[model samples]
Target: MKLIAVTNDRMSIDELIQTLLAIEPYIDAVILREKSKTDTEILKLIQKLKEVNFNVKKMIVHGKPTIANTEQIDKVQLPGGLPLPDLMRQYPALLFGKSVHSLEEAIVAEADGAESVLYGHLFKTNSKPGLQPRGTDDLRRIVSSLTIPVYAIGGIRPSHIERLREVGIAGVAIMSTIFESEHPKNIAKEYYDAIHT
Candidate 1:
């Protein structure tokens, strides 16, 4: 249960590398979720990350278990919309986490063999515009229905970590709070401090 931040392939390679390096120390995992990167681009990004001696073991990418398997990364996260195949159960391999916005969706993910689910929008977020916020109470209700770990997402920051901790959430997931910062390292530290507190 820890912070998992992702990088957008939208950034140039240099910017991408810098951001990853800056926040590496505070991150429990880095999810390389670039949607449009060609295979060559993806390979280049992976190689650059390795060159910096970043802990590749703590990395996860969407649907590319081949890359994760070959690179020996920590986990593989699948997009919420995709169906999890029966073959996933055979791996006994890396952690498998998925995103879900509803209790039913959460249940589906668990039934489909996800190790954990990323529950979201406890507060309205720009990334999830127009979606109703599920507040802490609703979040608690969702977590209580599942046996595996649940990580809270959407509008979470250093300030909100304690409330989530109080409710017994396994961890927190953040995206823009760290990525949009000029100093992502400091922001990550702030989130780590809040969670630890």
Candidate 2:
């Protein structure tokens, strides 16, 4: 399974870069999901990552197709219900991804031409509190409906990999559990091991 690291608002610029650098080797990509960051701010962060020799291509800018195109980053993840079919046609060069909550949305995304979808809250994590998890059955249903990949997200842990893979998810995306860990590299490695095992 492909492991993606989703960024949160808590980390400072330095800590974020350090975390990205440490975990880069283990994760397939990093979704820069700092939703509040302005387009200019996201662009500057992209520049910084490139300056540090990080793989900018593996970084997916959240909700900013213009910035992503100008930066030549090649991937932009749109928030749910943004109606990306037009954007996908407009920027054929860009890989468009989405965040979907249900099978119906996943099918809409697929029909609308999203290259992939990120789905979940599979087991409850600090990122999402109190709400009940959508669980593996829901995940499997979504996976079954889409030809494009569906990545499980929200509250995922290392121990859940086997079941996720069994359900036919393309990969997993994580947030707080990775960034808050004492050793981001080791945390990423643990997930990688679970994926490859």
Candidate 3:
């Protein structure tokens, strides 16, 4: 399975870069989901990342198609409720993804030219406490119903890999786990092995 790491707001910019670089070889991509940062700040960070020659193609800007287009970044993952139809037409070289919660939303996202989707809350995550998990059954249905890649997100752990694989997911997007790990390199390797072996 493809392993994409999602960034959290808790870390400093330098820490973020160090963590991403450490694990880049193990993970497939890094989704820059820094929603708290201003557009200018995000764009600057994107530029700096490119300046450092990081694989920008492996970076997905969250809800920022313009920045993606400007930087020629290949992927953009739209957050929930942000509307921009026919993304393929506007950003021809870019692949768009969406975050969805249910089968209905997943279908809608696929219909909206989203090449991939992130669906979950599959387990009790620290970030989202007191919420019911969507579970593997719904994950199975979502995966079966869509031709596009469905990456399970939220509360994904190394132990969950077998169930996720059985449920037919294409990949996973994990935040907190990689970003907050004291040894991101080892954790990333563990995640990769879990998915592949």
Which tens-of-lDDT digit does each residue in 28-104 have in candidate 1?
88778887987677778888899998788777777676677666775778777765765375455767888788889
lDDT of each: 0.79, 0.88, 0.87
lDDT of 3 by residue, 33-86 (tens): 998888888888887777777887789999889988888888899888976476
| Model 3 lDDT, full chain set | 0.87
Error at 113, model 1, angstroms: 1.3
**TM value for model 3:** 0.94
List TM-score per model, in order: 0.90, 0.96, 0.94
- Model 1 ranges off by over 4 Å: 87-92
Cand. 2 TM to true fold: 0.96
Which sections of candidate 3 miss by over 4 Å? 84-88
Give the Å error, residue 119, model 3.
0.2
lDDT of 2 by residue, 22-123 (tens): 999999999998877777777778889999999986999888888888989889889886869789878889999999888888888888889999987788
Highest lDDT among the candidates is held by which one?
2
